[model samples]
Target: MSPLTTSSRRRILFVGEAVTLAHVVRPVVLARALDPARYEAVLACDGRYLKLFGELPFAWRPIETIPTVKFLDNLAKGRPVYTAETLRAYVRDDLALIEAVQPDLVVGDFRISLGVSARVAGVPYFTITNAYWGPYSQLPFPLPEHPMTKVFGVGVSQALFNLARPLVFALHTLPLNRVRREYGFPSLGTDLREIYTHADQVLYADIPGFIPTAPLPPHHCWLGPVLWSPEIKPPDWWDAVPEGRPIIYVALGSSGENERALPIILQGLADLPVTVIAATAGQPLGIKPPVNAYVADFLPGAEAAARAALVICNGGSLATQQALAAGAPVLGIASNMDQHLNMLCLERAGVGARLRVGPLTAKQVRKMTERLLGDAGCRQAAGRLRETLRDWDTGQVFAARIAIQGGDGQTTATQP
Candidate 1:
């Protein structure tokens, strides 16, 4: 087939959650992978991610909408909370965005409501999630903390997770149902748990060690990690890192929980010997780094990871993966369900360690950092994972799959 004659472009819409840069970053990589002649991609996310997407060539539509809401009661009590009203608003806005875009295929990165909206609109929908979120997922191991919350000591966390799973599903569904009725869309009859299981394609971004899945649905695809690069230029100081010492990069994703946890992290890493480069990302914790630490509002994760000896973070998947790709071990202090789960996966893979935020102290941080730096095992394991990552072209692979599904025909295009 002639190249020009075989290339076909299809309009694609990406609905991302602006709660963190990871959500936006995943889609951006996928967009870059897409063939310009075979796909015209537009991103729908909040204004905060605009700068993150500014350097991309594709057109962007800012959707000043919330695709999910944390329950205030949950936040106040330091527990998982869900509200019907919040879900309703999220679904409503998501539906509106879908209607406005009306693309051939809709891609949702952890934005649950968008899948439902696409389904209702009779559009093909795809989503990326960890295997932990899969229907048959059972926690493979114990949580580092919260032993009391465990059920049988054999995956007790998993058991309790199973126990509360129904109620949590209801919490997500009630609001979506309310919005569906309000918007004149037919009720799905199923709850949120079942709703998540209904996507036209469900891509699990995690590797096998963390979440072991068997006999999954035909729509399920495990595409591994989708690595990303930020468009923002690194600060002038980035070029000046000391030549001999290994660098340690730290950044928390844009989440309220992360903002609250930053002080604890700053206090923990204060006396570490490694050269630390911290990306504040607009969250100020009122702590100054030592002369060895480089603080900036943002820097490209890919670049930082390439130069780092280790990475300290709130367990954002994209950041962690980038570090691992660069043969750097990670120390993760996570604050939310997804972040905690992502950290657990990394730990299970033997590439990182997780520290609980509650009862966190400088002593524990110092100990963890010392262990990671002093021992060569962590770095060796990270290097091995990096080799595996280097073997796969995740962005191009995922984009090719999408192009095939959308019937766009450019299966061999080189991804950016």
Candidate 2:
């Protein structure tokens, strides 16, 4: 088909889970990058994300599917937990949606079940995930901890993960593989481990600074971070931010991590000579901010980063990338594996520092924040990295690649 042919306006389906805003926001930005004349996009997600995509220029399809396993509870209990029924339900719903839409291409943002459905439907599919999930993850860095937890924690964790890997695979594949067999779709292979490898493309939604490029399978593409801008109006007090002191933007994403960390952050910033903009995100901690702090339920991250001197966050990729884009240094207090990895990248890139959750203290957070704000070198380094990232123009680069790939229906070789 020619690039300008009617078939070039390929119908695309995007599936996202509303467990977090990252999944919703990333796809919206990519959907916006496609030319209206060249793509007809439809989004499928839970009801919570309905309003999120309502403002976007695309068809919205609501699917009642719970997308994530409750890993947080499992982690806290130091046990492996699997939600088999949830996975099956999601697969069923997603397959129904695929049958209805009949999209030429389907894209999933962190929703692996959607990829399975697309495969069953014989349609090409893509997924956006962190590169750390790939074999390139380097973690378990040295740190002071309880002697027992320090000496045995890593080994125990690794052992448990290895032991549970097959069980986890079976929990998901039992249902999906059964459906594939019933439909005469080729069984995903003898060892069901390959079930996770269904996508035609696996786009790593992280920037180079976070996950440096390395040799990988041909199906993988490091698409950098997807930059998103929300349309929410800033609070009236936004214009009243104090002057002469550096402005620090503090947010813990939208999943209530702020509830635990916000008060500590407030206590840390109490005596500092800086203006703190804390995003409560409608999850209050019952602590009022000090004199130099401005607290809001929500603020558009891009707008806040544009005026920030520094950013304090839970090391979410979206927040960190937005701050880096605005040339702001970061002080990340990470509470999860992914957050820890992203913070490591920021520190290596000379744009930020990290405080792991186990041993984290208000004093250490304050010290790091103050040091980052006071150091001229940190700001200069962040500015340089920001310039380099701007040169990448991540959205435009990915958009052009999509256009090229969709110009003809023929599948091309995937990027490594």
Candidate 3:
């Protein structure tokens, strides 16, 4: 493929790994937010969440992604999610897509194969990722729940984890490095951070200063949070949710073990002087909803979050950002490392609290919910953070980056 000339609008391709909804949603949202006149956007991903997006302005192409069950199981077992052979297959598919789309630049959210595919195709690549995964992150890594954590207590497991985390991270980088070596590229080194961020440009979908990091490379910059919500309509009970009491919105998301957690959440808040609105993410709710709680399979997250006095979720960036975007305090019931890392930042920012899923209890949820709902400080912090998020035009920043990369060298892109 020839280089794109200045006279033509740049064609940008976005590839999202469909292992989780957040991965697919981030890229789709960014693609939707682009300046159509200056950029031709194409999105390629598995069709798991496409129904939620409704009609799109840009072109959509189908692609293969590993099963979500396999991905989550790997995370739970502390195993690397991808294998050398799996990534090798992904590279072939990505290259085929690159040939078909012929994009001037490629943007990926958790589509790790692009690290090898884009480079081999001689295309510039940009990655959308959280700051906590970057090399410069100053936040501590809490040991995720693994077999070791269950065998040994958290205290002992955490200590062992601290001692072995470096080795474990290196091991996780092997599959990607092996694929890179096959493509005649040098190893991205043993650091998983470097492997994940290996691209021509890296965009962090997070608030500035919310997570401390060292000085970033010029190509690495904040694009702010790419906030997106499903297009699902509110349940019939939405209007009927009582107005006088505090409203607590609950959505544990897909990555965590929601089956066990949802019951605890409902039980904890059963007698509280609040209204509970929970989204079950389409999973069957084995137990009945409490009198004060309303249950649904899906909810428009942004609107649901905006109306809540408190937001509870899986502690992943997408849900937490949704709550913080609405100026609502959060109580994260986190299970995975990604969730833990994200929740750590929110906790440090004083806008939220994090509780592990392993030992979650009704009493703990009630205590945390009462504390967050009653504490003026949590709401105040969330309000301030909401203002900060408002100042960051994520779409404009991303468009400006594309403009500069396409030789326009502009700080902002004009939108229609």
Candidate 4:
């Protein structure tokens, strides 16, 4: 296809930091939502998930990211995911891409290097993140599934974590600040959230009721939850799952780390009268399945979430959002801070409960699963959120927000 004249179409480039599918899928959802006649879209990211996007119509490029296990291990070890070295490399790639694309706007999903690269390149920058991390948002520090949590127990671990969180945030902020300083940009202080979300525009893919923030600026707007699921053939066992019983769908998601949790979850639910549909997400679990359980390597999440009486996941927002969208409450077995934060909102909205993944037991899993199964209140709360999502066109909202900022690629804070 021939390039359109610059005057005829606005160019937008979406850069993803694909440590997992969520980061990559979020931006892909936005990019696919734009009107091709009005915008020229390009996606640049680590090449790992190119097929996951599955035949993109837009221009695509490969950019290296730190290995997935490296990123996951950092979360597991309670260390910062990015190092100064990593950020420096990212900045270099961001600059190279910006120069090549000459995009009118750059939208990034967790491509933190854009905190500096976009400003230096004179391109308008937009960062997609959860609203809970917004500076103005109200948040609670909860202990995640970790070695410390197991050692100290949930209550004491949370108390100590709440006290040390500021220092922890500061420690994580250093790599970004150090990278920014190296590139002649001043430090964004010590708050990692602030550093993460700093941009010409910050778009949150969450709804207001689920995560209300201190009044946001016009430049910062809610884009709702930009959700996606790959189209794939249903598993052969899919037809065998009886529709007569209450269905429970369990998927720990790609990032949830504890493959060991699968057998425990299956065993915990073994005695239940419900049919359990479980996705190992390509992880192999050695446990023999109960007659009531169906296991697959993957399943279309939205379908499973919609059909289930309840959803159990890693407590990350993507799966939680899908479940809530389907009016199904979730049982979040959270292992990291991100999952913990998502569960915090789910619990607040009265639609979900959080279980620390570190100390997770078959008995505890059974208890929470039973609670969600029997409680009408959880389904009621999920129904309310489901209704709210009905009016949300997340991709369209993201596109329109960027379009309104098109003239000079600058945003005005909701001025009357």
**Tens-digit lDDT string for candidate 3 (179-250):** 988888888889899988887788999977999999987778999987888887788888988979999999
**What does each candidate score in C-alpha RMSD?**
5.7, 4.5, 3.4, 3.0
- Model 3 segments beyond 4 Å from truth? 408-416
Score residue 345 of candidate 1 by CA lDDT: 73
Model 1: worst 10 consecutive residues (lDDT sum): 407-416
Identify the superior model by lDDT, candidate 1 or candidate 3.
3
Assess each prediction's global lDDT (C-alpha) against the native.
Answer: 0.68, 0.70, 0.89, 0.84
lDDT-wise, the better of 1 and 2 is 2
TM-score of 1: 0.83
| Tens digits of per-residue lDDT for model 2, 1-416 | 11223555778788877667787777777887777887888988776645533377888888765433354544334332334455567778888887888777778876656645665666777877777655444533332122334456755745655666556445545655665555455656533334444577777776653666457675666787677656677889998897677888888876426766788888888898888887887787678778888888778788898889998887878788888889999888776556766777888878899876555678988899878988898899999878876777667766655654566644532211
Q: Candidate 3, overall lDDT?
A: 0.89
Sorted by lDDT (best first), the order is 3, 4, 2, 1
For residues 1-416, could you state the per-residue lDDT of candidate 4 as single tens digits?
A: 12223478878889999998788888888888888998889999888867655689899988888888898889888799999988888988899998988887789998998888887777778899999888878787676666786678788888898898899899999999988787777788988888878987889989876786789987788889877776667899887789998999999977875478888888999998899998887888788888899988888888998899999999998899999899999999888888988899988889999887777889998998889889998899899899898779897788678767765535632211
Model 1 lDDT per residue over 342-390, tens place: 7777787778997766456778877998888886877898999998888
Top candidate on lDDT is 3
Instruction: Return the top candidate by TM-score.
Output: 3
Whole-model lDDT, model 2: 0.70
